[model samples]
Target: MSDLAKDAASMAKGSAGLRGAPHHTAKPLHDFKAASHDLSALGALGSLLKATGDIRDGMNTLSALTESLSEEWNAEAKLLGEVSDAFDLLDVLLSAAARAKKG
Candidate 1:
């Protein structure tokens, strides 16, 4: 069994002992208080687990976004390279035209 399951089992056992005890004694009251504190700790643990799940989800989303951005940047880079090549060809053609006109 998991550590969490073991902890929950132990907490349940500890609280169960307080159910039939007289309310007048100091030890049962102390035990009850300790059980209440344990329950509070369990609640905090639950919240922490939820927060951890949220963080995992956020990280997955960020990873997907990064991948999408990388694809887009690659495409944009290819397009820019093509545009640069076209500009270079245009410069060559214009230079040739000017030489032909002069000759």
Candidate 2:
């Protein structure tokens, strides 16, 4: 009798009728496949947009740096032209002084 009681107890413990996790029901295969495809598509689109935004940011930074460098180069060129003019003036003054000393 005790053996029968033990068997009954074991069966009850293992049975789904007792308190435990709920059993899962299967859905249609097409429904699962469609939802999975939609999720994958959305994931790919998100990655593409993120990459585009990164590229746009990099281009903007490059453009700003190029503009900045161009401005510096212009300023340097202007200053160098001024220095060259000063040197030409100095040469003319030296030539006049030499002529005065000789005459």
C-alpha-based local distance difference test score of model 1: 0.52
Per-residue lDDT over 52-99 for candidate 2, one digit per residue giving the tens place of the 0 to 100 score: 455446555655565565556556555555554555566667678889
- Candidate 2 residues lying further than 4 Å off, grouped into runs, are 1-46
lDDT of 1 at 53: 51
Error of 2 at 73 (Å): 1.4
Candidate 2 has an lDDT of 0.49
Report the C-alpha displacement of residue 84, candidate 2, in angstroms.
0.9
Candidate 1 regions off by >4 Å? 1-49
Residue 89 CA displacement from its true place in model 2, Å: 0.4
Cα lDDT of model 1 by residue, 1-103, tens digit = 4343444455444444433233334464455544543444445665776664554465556555655655565565555555545555666676788899999
Top candidate by TM-score: 1
Q: Between which residue pairs do clashes occur in model 1?
A: none
TM for every model, in the order presented, reads: 0.53, 0.52
